[model samples]
Target chain A: MSTDLPEWLLARQEPFQHGDGIAGGKSIRRGFVEKSVDSMSLVFRESFFAERLASRPGLLQGIDPRVKVLTTILLIIVAGLARHPTTLLALNLWILWVAKVSRVPLPMYLKRVWLAAPLFTGIIVFPSIFNVVYPGDPLLILINFSRHFRLGPWTVPETLAVTYQGVWGALVLILRVGASVSLAVLLALTTRWQVLLKALNMVFVPQVFIVMLEMSCRYIYLFLQTTSEMFVARRSRTVSRTSTQEQRCFVSGSIGALWNKAYILSGEIHAAMVSRGYTGTPKTLVSFQISRLDWLWSLFVLAVSLFFLGGDRIVAW
Target chain B: MHIPDGYLSPQTCAVMGAVMLPVWAAAAKKVNNVQKTKYAPLMAIGAAFTFVIMMFNIPVPDGTTAHAVGGGLLAIVLGPWAACISITIALAVQALLFGDGGILAFGANTFNMALLLPFSAYYTYRLIAGNSEAASSRRWLGGLAGGYIGVNLAALAAAVEFGLQPVLFHAADGAALYCPYPLSMAVPAMALAHLSIAGPVEGVITALAIRYLQERNAGILSVEASSSPLEGHSYKKLMRGLGMLILLSPLGLLAKGTAWGEWAAGEIEAKMGFIPGGMSSLAERWQAPLPDYGLPGFEHNLLQSSTVYIVSAIIGLGIIFAITYIFSLVQKKTTPDKT
Candidate 1:
């Protein structure tokens, strides 16, 4: 082994890499490993963001999670019942206001809700806004066929135009989805995961369900780390990208291997539980405390729900 | 695949939620009665395994990566009821922590993904693999068929749910207030995506996984059988033949057409005489928060509109990372060192 090195070379350290990960045959696809790493990082990033959002000192954060959970469901129901566009808009604004009070980054909150909702919903609802799907008065004429075209049981009209009512209907659907998602996102962002799970007890959520939620949340990161480690180990040993067939083989093998590990991991976890005082029921230390503020918030939510429902009925009549 | 909130009427959400409550309770009771205290940790691990399985983006021959819900695979491995419980928990976590699915729509999502998928997968696998030996290649074939059919069945169930919305619930003007598409459109649209893309990916993965387990260590199959090496070559050949078939399956999706309901307004008008009254009447009712996914002042012109969408996406991503980074920094600053 050569021990001698230049002073500059000795002082500078090489970046740490996964051990012996560069020795594969010529069939390797480096992109595969990178893609896995990228997705793994994405999982971690999302969790980190959620944890940060949950811990912020804000309006919803201070309330008891049980109250928040119930209130959110109630609000969602109200939002769903909303028929008038005005009422839906108001509810959306109210959710944004709640998000603001809860100290969630407003821009990020809007961005999150809108990005997920409108982009996809927009695509889904796009065709609904024309004269062909939902018939109504034409808002804008896009084309005029020389003669009506018929295909099987369907008929294509001579004139094609965007319908007035079709666009209206599409708008309502988009707004409703966007608002609903906003409220749901607000609830998740403002409450800690464990606390939220525990709060499900108030709704009589089964203890087993709660236990599963807690355990899954706890071990997901652990398993995720293990998976990335496995990938890294594989990548470190490969000098070139594996062939597609080999890639598929590796993926299938990894899935089976992971399942076996999960089986063993379950036994180990069970044994650890037993060692800790094996009981049928697992308990956590966090206790719920409902303050006047929680009650006030609950009352506020109830009142809003009533008003929205009432307004909807009035608008209907 | 997740139906966001507001796609269903409140009545629909309530009805679905009521239906799911009992299923969850029964599943919990059964699991508790069977596994008792040990059930919690094992099922949790299983659910966690499922969550990670979904994260693996398996590359298919079409130059696209697909993820299997693993509902069928789990059903086969842990039994259907256990799989149901595990998947429901994973879905709840997704809805609560990540907002991948709607909270109010949780029941519908659960019904489709958890109950429909796993149960269908279980029965289909059983029907095909009946009385087959533990190491029989037939078992793997059963998995392949079950996975392909299971996913398509679940997709069908979802499509039905979505399609029924417009017919079952509508405003006075004959406009659909919930999902705008009729069954005529929803079924084919959903079927095309699942059958062409997701089905084969799931089938191949499930079959390959089971085959690998059988070859590597059949002990995980939880069956007590004498070890034998005599049948190895035949099994290998069977798998290779199946592999070739799986590779060609994506070609079915190459049909020169878009999903029925997925066409643009212009495209639909060109295809049909007029938009369905129920869908068009309701669509014009409200403005999107981001009309056409662009900022208020910058809603027109292709260049600016796309730039706005991209900018908004980047902003959201940047802010999330930035806030988390700041939180970490703050925690470090506040904590006292043990020096």
Candidate 2:
């Protein structure tokens, strides 16, 4: 049966030599920069597609950016205030509806929000479900120890089970996280970056901050492209896996070189701006126009938020 | 150390936000006095550099890859104040654009990664480097220690913020509604992770980066020079900021055993055999405008409360700036030749 297995199923490496014990057991993966560049590019592509979605003639895409920003904040606040799981679920469904109308890719959107929240926040909340961690009514027993026990200064519970309250609390916590993340993701996907930044500006974000944020956003892609090229050039020149010290030295050197490049780039950028009569304040060509539809949408969102809050207040759980 | 939303209570967020506003105002004033126009593009690039640096994946010896937060390097390259603003902008972008952290939790995140991380790192580096020549090896050692301690301190702050959520806010059943972990669990886990992995990685990177810069360009630190008009006024400002934070820290203690909304008249009686007078009075009182950190007479809504908190923070920030300005003026009169 082992011989019948595919050759690719087995690990490929040199056999252990004389005096070598578990040297071959170690797994050393290469292409760190290549992997990072690939992932970063993936994120860039996703955000790029999202920007394209923002230009489409979708529901949220039509609303004023200021309204959308405020409405998103309002909805997120409601999500934070929510106590019941059902309320959070309803908010999740509402975000789905928004994403659907906004024409964002539903699978990508769901995967981005759902896969991340449960995977990251879920792990944090996982321990809370055990009776040993959080004392409550037993829901399902996982282990049954002696009648009583003691470990050091801490008393040990005789039985270990998933508590009903713990499970409910975890569910509520997860749902809140999921709902908030979904709303944030929805807002990000359905709005242009510049427009969203402008909205932040109108909402009393300092001009200096807005200027820095806009400039940073514009230059980040350039820097990222430069960084990836540097890594690829280095990788192409490599013969085999270099020592860890060499890698560390290379990373530090690359960082320093990048810093130098950024320094020069800043000077050049400043010169270009000065030549163009640029002042400290940032001015954009795209202006915000809140239409009648925007007001209606704002009211609709307000009503929805109030309804959720009222439902949370009335519900026992 | 980026705290996601719902991990901290709103009150905690408000207090931190209030604290940061003054610090930001002070930083801006100081930066403006140093290199007014030159610092603008530099700060912008610094922010962009920070944003890009966080994306770099470094392979550690443990057969796993982790990225650097770049706070220590930012402080070394730019001054700590400039680093604070740059990292704050980067963090805000991360929170708003990418949803990496919570919008509501931005204040706490900034307090941890931006202020505490860079300030602690920069000061530690300065203390250790201690008038050593620019090319001395002590600078590198200082960088190493600064970077390691910087990341650990940031992690500890974040862990405390997370641990406090459950103790400060929970359901009536004693079930944690926010972060479920208590301090004992949070602190040790955070400390161990940082001490073992990220701290050392940051230390190595910081030291190596400094050495590389020392070899290549000697003019980098000039862009982050220390001289400023308000040089002699930092102590009072720091004290005022800490005083504000201390005043608000007790709010965390106000409802030590109280849950969010599950308070029952008989439940307190059953637990303590008598309801504490303070607790009973608090429950009876009407909602304050700022509630906890907000101004009074604001509407009993989150938006209103948050708005008031922001206003109060702005007010506090202006007061700090005014005091600093007056102190500088007085110093200039008393010792006109000091500069």
Candidate 3:
């Protein structure tokens, strides 16, 4: 039966190695590889696309980007200031709930939140190792490692042990990052980029910025499409092509060409914009109303955030 | 560089906002002054280009990467005040639309990258290129120096913004929280890294683009000439302008040396005493309270102290220039030729 499986199926069956060894043997095969692939397939399905295509109809969607902007700002502040693990965890759970209520897909939420993993690893894990190895805190000695080496006479005694505090700190950092990223992703997913820009403009965001963003967003897609076509053309021209370096060169050349094209296109776009009476400012059709729902939502979120913050303060006190 | 909200004290953000408002107003006023109907399209296009280019990150060695915000390049082409307004707009849009930076930090970010960098680069370019013929080599060199200073100035501004978080805000322990990393260490490290990284990226792009534009459409350069007397000059005159270049190089070195000296002095003072003044006392008074600078361990290290100082000086210097320019606008009627 195994021999009858196709080469691609065999390749897909290969065991995956995780950095932390947190996953069990069966879980790695079932959870990571199979489940993730299934999740990705679901993400790209017609139904999924259709759902996304359907205009956002929630209270959050209609609120001005400016108000959303304010909410985002408040959320980030509340999350960052929540020092205790319990509070941070509560905030994370609340964010997850909000994401669920807002109809954000689970896989999409997980993928975006996963970006925080690397940051957590770099800033928390890497630094925590150094902290644990040092002998100042007894808590550091309890968690990470067992080695200890004394420096010269003047220096404070150092140990190479990971402690409880170091582990706790790393966990806290991860939680913080997870919460922040979740909030940001939620905002990005819920809010349309154009509406956000308009809302920003209303809130005293400079006109130059709005116009720049509009042009760049428009041009970037065109640039990408043009470059992809160029890439295909280059691939067809090349004989006996398979070298990574050659592929890189071809891509880079396409990029250089794309840059020139973009420059020229900018001029054309500028002329077109001028002909259409573009007067150094971007025009948007979407008008923001700070509806009662927006106010209620903001207050509810604020109340939840305050609860976490207040709880953290009380616990620490 | 994007100091998230709550990372900074409310007071510090307010101070930065107060300092930035008039500079922005002045930039707006300057834009109003140059509001020729023909120039409007070009300005919009230029603004668009700024946003597009910044999205393309040039890799740097220090784990962080940067891209050309083109504030200096824009200032050279569109004059400082107009550049400020345009760059400010670009930054604001980036924050809101793309999440490239935090919205709350918008004031500091704009003041640092837009107002300070461009104006500084313009003055530096004027000093180097002078009122002479624009040689390709001289132009490249001026662009290189302008770019180098401009990026470092921006980085310094970033460090200061980070450092001031601890200074203006009180930690849970009631101690003044400032950036844990000293400016000396952080500044040199950042400046040196960016000097090799974003500096070259900006220089090459600015020079090549400027040259291409000059060759293909000299009209754009001509438009800039009205606002900037330095543009469209002969290469011979700019070469003769080498005197200022020679003088400024040594002056830059002296300034760097003095900055290093101050940092060294601070370190020596900290070492002579066991406690490092502000945060340490706060830590002592409030047991297990979060360190003023968020970093948990390694609080008293020399590396951290030096970084704080270097970063602060960069921010302080940029702030000084921004403040000076705002004041210059107030005195603009008297100094009509300065722009």
Which predicted model would earn the best lDDT?
2
Candidate 1 A-chain TM-score = 0.85
iRMSD in angstroms, per model = 7.8, 16.1, 16.6
Residue B124 in model 3: lDDT: 71
Best by TM-score: 2
Q: How would you encode candidate 3's per-residue C-alpha lDDT over B148-229 as one tens digit per residue?
A: 6877788787766665443333335422222233344346656776677776666655555555554545455434556652
lDDT of 3 by residue, A1-317 (tens): 54987787676443224321243433332221222223323323423343352234443444456777778878776766665666677667666655554446667667657564436334524443334231223453434334445456333334445545445444555666566656665666667655555666655756654555565445544443454455445534544423433332333333334445554665676677788887755566665667555565567556655656655665444
Per-model C-alpha RMSD:
13.9, 14.5, 16.5
What's the lDDT for residue B277 in model 3?
69
Better of 1 and 2 by TM-score: 2
Q: What is residue A2's positional error in candidate 3, in angstroms?
A: 26
Candidate order by TM-score, decreasing, is 2, 1, 3
In order of listing, the candidates' clash counts read 41, 1, 37
- Report the lDDT tens digits of candidate 2 across residue range B1-339: 788776666677767787788788877777766756665676788888888888888778865577888899889777788889889988977887888888878888998999989988888888888777667788889889999999999999899888877777777677677788888889998999999999998999989988988888866744455442336677487768778776876675454554555667678788769998888887789664544555666758979876775565455444434433443344234332311
Cα shift from native, residue A11, model 2 (Å) = 26
- Among all windows of 10 consecutive residues in model 2 chain A, the one with the lowest summed lDDT is A14-23
Better of 2 and 3 by DockQ: 2
